[model samples]
Target chain A: MALLDVRDLSVTFSDHHGRRRVVDGLSYSLDAGGSLAIVGESGSGKTQSALALMGLCGPTADVGGSVRLDGRELLGLPWPALQQIRGQRIAMVFQDPMTSLNPYRRIGGQMTEMLTLRKGLSADAARTECLEMLEAVQIGDPSNRFTQFPHELSGGIRQRVMIAIALLGRPDLLVADEPTTALDVTVQAQILRLLADLRRAMGMATLLITHDLGLVAGLCDEVLVMYAGRPAEQGPVDDVFARSLHPYTRGLLHSVPRLGRDPGRAPPARLQAITGSPPAAGDAGPGCAFAPRCAYRFGPCDEKQPEFAAVAGSRRVACHLESPP
Target chain B: MTLLGVEDIDVVYPGRSRKDMPVRAVDGVSLTVDAGQTLGIVGESGCGKSSLARALIGLAPLSRGEFRLGDSIVRAGERRWPRRLREEIQMVFQDPVSALDPRMPAWQIVAEPLAIHRPELNAGQRRERSMAMLDRVGLTADLAMRYPHQFSGGQCQRIAIARALVVEPRLLICDEAVSALDVSVQAQIVNLLAGLQDELDLAILFISHDLAVVHHLSQRVAVMYLGQVVESGTREQVYGLPAHPYTRALLAAIPDPARLELPAVLDGEVPSPTDPPGGCRFRTRCPHAIALCAKSPPPAVAVNGHHAACHRRDELTRPAPG
Candidate 1:
C-alpha cells in the first residue's frame, strides 16, 4: 500500500470574488521510501497543493477531498488530530531558512523544546538527541553551533539546521518546497545531496516541490508536472523527461538553456519561449487551463478540459492530443 | 580602442568604525567590451559582480584604477560624473517591480531619462520618443499609460529595458536584469536585448549568476570569485576549456537534464569577505588546494588567449578522468 495517497485534493479561498480554487483536483500517491516532485512555474498552485496535503493551509483556505496516510483519512481531522500528525508523521522544509526559524531563540533551544514536547523526552535526553540530530545533518562542531542563533550562521548552515529540526521527530514523509532556491549553486548542490542521503538513511518518502525541471530529474523518482494548478503530466522521472507527452512539459524543457553545449557551436538563435502567461486563479474558464499557451492546442482543448488518461507505459498525461496506442 | 576598457578597477567599502574591517567588494578587476558586444560577468552572490557594475556607472566609488568609455577616461574617486558620461551609460537593475516608481505610469518613467538629458525636446517629442522606445521593446504604445503594478513581471522588465535604452546610451550595464523573471519571460528579454544590441551597436556589461544564460548571450565571459576575476576568455574558451578550478566547478554545478552526471561539488560556503583568507580566497573550498595556495595568491596565466588565476591551471584544464 502507498504511504501517502491523495485523491482529488482541492484548495479554495473565499474572497470578494467568490471561492477561487487555486489547487484543482490534484491527486498523486507516494509509496514508502519513494520520492515524487511537483514541478511548475509561479502561480501554478504547486505550493498550495503541498500545503493542503499537510493541513497547513490557514483558516482562509478550504481544503477538500481525501488525503490518506497509511490508509487513514486525513481530511476533516480536528485541530488536535492534525497537529499530532503534522510533525510526528510528516515534516516540512520551507523555502527560506531565515524566516522559517525563530530569530530570537538559540538553535539548540528550539530543537530541545520540540523534542521534549513531541517525543516526551526528558530535558537532558532532549539535549542529547538535539546534538545527535545536528551531527547527523553533517553540521561540524554541533556543540559550538548549539548556542548560536539563526542569524549567527550562514544561509547554508541555517538551512541544514532547519532540516535537522524537521527530522527531529523522525517523520515518515518529508515535504520540501523549493528548499534550494534561495541558495547558491554550490550550496544548493550540498543541500540536495544532504536531502537525498538523509531520506535514504531514515527510510522516508519525499515530496519535493520546485520550479526547476533539472532539479526534478536529479532528485526525484517520479514527477508530476503542473500547469495552472492542474497536472499536465505524471510518470517516472527518466521516462517523462526522456519522452514528455504534454506540450507544456516540452515547452518548459525547450525554454531552459542547457549547460555544456558543444564549445564552438552557436546556441539556438532564439529560445522557443512559451508565448503567454498562466491564467489567474479560478479564471481558467471551461476549457484546458494551458490552451492559451500550448502550441499543440486543438479545438477540444479550447472547448473542454482533458482528463488525465494513461499514455505510454506507466505514464499519464492530460492533453487532447495524447492517447495510448 | 575598446568601446569600454576597465583597467585594474577596485571598489572598497571603508570600515564604519575602528572595530570593523574594510570590505573590498571588487578587487583589481579588468575587462573590455567592444562595440555591439556583450561581456558577461558571472559569479555567485557576494562575489562582487554587482559592485563592479555599480562602479562602472559611478554609483559605487572606485577605490583605485581607471576605466574609459569611448574616448573619455573616468578616474577613481571622481565626486561627480560628467553629464556626457552619464548620458552615454545606463543601467537596468534586477527587480523590475521595485526598480520602477509606483506613482509614475510607464510612459512617464520611460520619458524621464529623456526629460533630464535632453531638455531641448518638447513634451510632445518626449512622449513620442517614449512610445517609440516602448514599441521597440515589444510593448505596445497603448499600454504606456498603465502603471508598473498593472503590468506583469515580464512586461515591467520590458518597460525597464525600454527606459534604459530611450537615452540611446552607448553602454548598458545590466545587473541580473532578467533573474527575477520566469524562464520563458527571461528568454524573451534576452532575445530583446540581443536584438537591441545589434540595432543600436551598444556594448553591454551583463552581470548574472546564471551560467547558461551568460553563455548564451555573451561573446566573452569572466568568472569572478571572492571579488576577483578568477578566469576570463572568449565564451568558447571559458565554457569549453575552463582553466580555474572554481570556474570548472561552477560550470559543472549547473543542473543540466541532458547531462545527468553529478557535478564535482565544491564543499563549504563562500568565506566572509571582511576577513578573507590569507592567500587565495577560494582555497578553503577548492578541491585542488595545496600548501602553496594558502601562502600566496595565484598569478594570472595566459593559455590560448584565455587568462586564469590559478597555480594549477594547466593540470586542472587537462581532459577529465573517465
Candidate 2:
C-alpha cells in the first residue's frame, strides 16, 4: 500500500447560493520517503486539499474520498483519534510563519508543548530536545532564540522554527504550503536546502505546495499541476518539466521570467492567457475546466468532463487531447 | 543628460533607542537614468534599495547626497517642495492598497497627482487626463469609481501606475511593486509597466528582491549589498557575465525552467544589516574569501563595462567560503 493514498477525493461547499464542488475527483498516492509537489496559482484549491487530508473540513462542506496514511483510513477517522496522530504521525507546516505562530508565546514554549504533549517526552527532556531541534534548523544561538517571541525573529528564522516544531514529532508525512513565498531568493535557498536535508535525515514523505515553478523544478521529485479544482497534469519532475502537455501547465511554466535575457527585450510569448477568469466551483459543467482558454480544445473537450488518462511513461494528463486512454 | 541623476546619496534612518546607532540604509550609492529607460535596483531585504529609491523621490530623508532632476536639485528632508521639483519626480510604493487611500474611489486617487501638481486645470480637463492615463495602463475608465478592495492585486497595481503617471513625471520609482501579486498577475503588471514606459517615455528606478524580475525589466542593473552598490552594469554584462562573486551566485540561484542543470551556489541566509561583517560585508559567505577580505573592504574593479567589488574578481567564485 502507498504511504498516503487519496482516491477520488471530492469536496463541495454549500450556502444560500447553492452546492459547489471545489475539489472534484482528486486522486494521488505518496510512497514512503518520497516527495510530491503541487503547483498552481492561488484559488486553485491547494490549501483546501491539504485541509481535507487533515480531516478538517467545514460544516457546509461535504467531503467524499478515501484518505489512507500508513494503512489507516484518515478521512472518516474520529476527531480524537485523528488528533492523536496529527502531530505525531502526519505533521503540517503552513505558508505564513508569522501568522501561524502565536505572538504571545515564546518559541521554547511552543516547541516544548509539541514534544511533551505529542511525543510523550518529559518536561526536562522536551527542553533539551527543543534546543536540539532549534540547532537542527541552524538557528544561531538557540538558547537565547528559544525565549524570543515570533516577532523577534525574521521571516526566514520564524519559518525555520516552524519547521523545527513540525519535525519535533518526527511525523511520517510533512505538508509544506508555500514555505518560502514570503522570503527573498537568498533566504528561500537556505530554507529549501534545510527542508531537503531534514527530509533526507528523517526519511519523511513530503508534499510541497507552491506556486513557483522554479522551486518545483529544483526541489521536487514528482510534480502535480492543479488547475481550477482538479489535477491538470502529473508526472516525474524531469518528465513534466520536459513535456508539459496541458495548456495551463504550459502557461505557468512560460510565465516565469528567466535570467540572462535582455531587460528591454519583448516579454516571453504568453500562450493564450487561459483567457477567462477561473470558473466558479458551482458553475463547473460537463467539460474540461480549461477548455475556455485552451488552444487545442475541441467539441469533445467541451461536451464531456475529461478524466485522467496516461500519455507517455509515468505521465498523466486530464484532457481529451491525450490519445484516448 | 540623464532625466534623473542621483549623485552619491547617503540615507540614514533615525535611531530608535538611546543605545541604538543610526542605521545607514543607503550609504553613498549613485546611479543615473535617462528618458525611455529603466534602471533596476536589486538586493536582499534590508540592503537599502528601497531607501535609495525613496530618497531619490524625496520620500525617504537623504542624509548627504543630492538629487538633481534635469538641472534642478530637489531639496531633501522636507515636506514642502518647490513646484518644479514636485512635478518632476513621482513615487509608486510597494503596497498599492495602502499607497492609494482606501476610503476614496480610484478616480480621485489618480486625480490627486494632477490636483497637487496642476491645481489650475479645470475639472473636465483633469477627468480627461485621468481617464487617458487609465486607458494607457490597460484599465477601463469604468473602474474609476470602484474602491481598492473591489479590484484584483494586478488591477490595483495598474491603478497605482495610472496615479503615478497622471502627473506626467519624468521619473517613477517602483519599490517591490509586483512582489505581492500572483504569477499571472505579476506577468500582467510587468508587461503593463513595460508598455507604460514606452507610452510615457519615463525613467523608472525599479526596486525588487527578485533577480529574474529585475533581469527582465531593467536596461541597466545595480546590485546592492548592505547599503552599497556591490555591482553595476548593463543587463547583458551583469546577467550574462557577472563579475562580483555575489552577483554570480545570485544569478546562479535563480531557478529557470530552461536551465535546471546548473547547481545552486548561494547557501546560508542573508545576514542582517544591523550587524554586518567587519571588512567585506559578503566575506563571511564568499566562496573565494582571502585573508585580506577580513582586514579591508574590496574596491570596485571595472571589467569591461561591468563593475564588481570583490578581492578576487577574476576567479569564478561560488556562494560558499572555501
Candidate 3:
C-alpha cells in the first residue's frame, strides 16, 4: 500500500457568508521514501489540504473524503487516536519557525520532552537522541544550540531546529508547508539540501507544500499544481514542466522570471502574464475556476468544469484542451 | 546623464545599551544610476539593501559619505533634504497593503503626494492627474473612489505604483516592491513598471532578494554582502559571468526548473553586522578562503566597468574551454 493515500478530499467551513469549500476534490498518493510537492498561490487551499489530512482543521471546518495511511482510514479519527498518529506516523513543519516553536522553552527541553513522553526514553537517552538528531540536520554546534531559545538562533538555524523536532518521532511522512519561504536565498538552499539529505538517509516520504515551481524540480519527484482548491495537473516533475497541458499551468510556467541561459545586453522579453487574479474562495460558478485567467479558454470552459483524468505520458490534468500547444 | 550618484556611504545605528556595539548597516557602498536606467541591488536580508535605500531617501542616518541627484548634492551631517530633491526621489515599500492608508480612497492616496509637493495644483487637477496615473498603472477610474481594502493584492500594488509615480519623480526606489506579490501579479507589475519607465524616462533603483527578478528588470546589477557591494556589472556580466565567489554561490543556490540538478549550497549564516569580519565580511562563509582573505580586504578587479571585490576574481571565474 502507498504510505499516504488521499481520495476526493474536501474541507469546508461555515461563516456568515455561508459554507465555503477551501479544499475541494483533492486526490493523490505517495509511496514510502517518495517526495511529492503541492504547488499553488496563496488562498489556493494548498495549506488547508495538508491540514485536513493531519486532522488539524479548526472546529468550524468540516473535512470529508478518505485519508488513508497504510490502509488505515485517518479521517474522522478520535482526538486521542489522531494525537497518537500525529507526531509518530506523520509530522508537520510550518513556514515560520519562531511562531511554531515555544519561545519560552529551551530547545533541549522542547526536543527531549517529546522523546521522553512519546518514546518512553529516559532523560539521558532522550537528550542523547535529540543531540544526534540535531547533528544529523547539520547543526554545527548542537550542544550550544540546545541551550539557546528560538530567538537566539538565526532564521536558518531555527528552521533546522524545527525539522529536528519533527524528526524526534522518526515519522514516516513529513508534511512541510513552505519550509523555506521565510528564509534568505542562500539559507533557503541550505535547508532544502538538508531536507533532501534527511529524506534519503531516513527513507521517509515528504509532502512539500510551496508556491515556487522552481523548488519542486530539484527536490520533489512528483508535482501537483492546485488552483482554487482543485488539482489542475499532476505528474512527474520533469514531464509536467517540459510540456504543461493545462492553460493555467502553461501560463504559470511562463510567468515566473528565470535567469537567462546565456546572458545578453538586449532588454528582457516581457513575461506572459495572466490577466486576472484567482477567484475569491467558494466563489465557484459550477464551471472551471481558471476560466477567467486562462488565455486559451474556450466555450465549454465557462459552462462546465473539466474532469481531472489521466492523459498520455503518465499525467493527470484538468482542462478542456486535449494536448500540449 | 547621471540621475543618481551614491559615493562611499555608511549607515550606523546606535546600540541599545552601553556595552552593545553600534550596528553598521551599510558600509562604504558606491554606485551610480543613469537617467532612464534600472540598477538592481540584490542581497540577502540584513545585507543593508533596505538601509541603503533608506539612506538615499533621507529616512536613515547617513553616518558618512554623500549622494547627489541631478544637480543637488547631499553630504553627511545634512539632516534636512531640499524640497526639490524630495520631489525628485520617491519610494515604494515592500508591502502594498500596509504601504497605503486604509482610510484614504484610491484617488486621494495617489493625490496625497501632489498635495504636499505641488501645492499650486488645485484638488480637481490633482484628482485628474492621479486618475490618469492610475489608469496607466492598469487600475480603472471607477476603482479610484474605493478604499485600499476593497482592492486585491495586485490592485493594491498598482495603486501603490500609481501613488509613487503621480509626483513625477525622476528616480523611483522600489525596495522589494514585487516580493510581497504572487508570480502572475508580479509579472504584471514588472511589465507596468517597464512601460512607465520608458514613457517617463525614469531612473529606477530596484532592490530585491529574488535574483531572477533582479536579472529581468536591471540593466546594471550590484550584488551586496554585509552592507558592501561585492560585485557590480551589466546584467550579462553579472548573471552570465559572475566573478565574486559570493555572487556565484548566490546564483548557484537558486533552484531552477530548467536545470533540475541541485546546485552548490552555501553554508553558515551571515555574521552579525555589528562586528563584521575584519578582512572580508564574506570570507568567513566563502568556500575559497585563504590566509590572505582573513588578513586584508580584497581589491576591486575591473574589466570594462564590470568589477568584483575578490582577491582571486580572475583565477576563479576563467571561462571553461569549449
Candidate that scores best on TM-score: 3
- For model 3, the stretches where C-alpha displacement exceeds 4 angstroms are A264-267, B320-322
Give the per-residue Cα lDDT of candidate 2 at B141: 75
Fill in the DockQ of model 3.
Answer: 0.70
**After superposition, candidate 1 runs with Cα above 4 Å error:** A261-264, A322-325, B319-322
TM-score for every candidate vs. truth?
A: 0.98, 0.92, 0.99
Residue pairs in clash, model 1: none
Among incorrect, acceptable, medium and high, the docking class of model 2 is acceptable
**Model 2 alpha-carbon drift over 4 Å, by segment:** A15-20, A58-60, A260-287, A297-304, A322-325, B75-80, B259-267, B315-322
| Pairs of residues clashing in candidate 3 | none
True contacts kept of each: 0.43, 0.36, 0.64
> Model 2, clash count?
0
lDDT of 1 at A215: 82
Q: Encode model 3's per-residue lDDT on A1-325: one tens digit a residue.
A: 8999999999999999899999988999999999999999988899999999889988999999999999999998999999889989999999999999999999999999988998899999999999999999999889999899999999999999999999999999999999999999899999998999999999999999999988898889999999999999999999989988888778888888887466445545687788888876567788899988887778898999899999986799999876666
Query: What is the Cα-based lDDT of residue B282 in candidate 1?
Result: 84
Summarize candidate 2's per-residue lDDT along B15-87 as a digit string, tens digits.
Answer: 8988887888887777788787899988888889988887766667888867788878764455565678677
Better of 1 and 2 by lDDT: 1
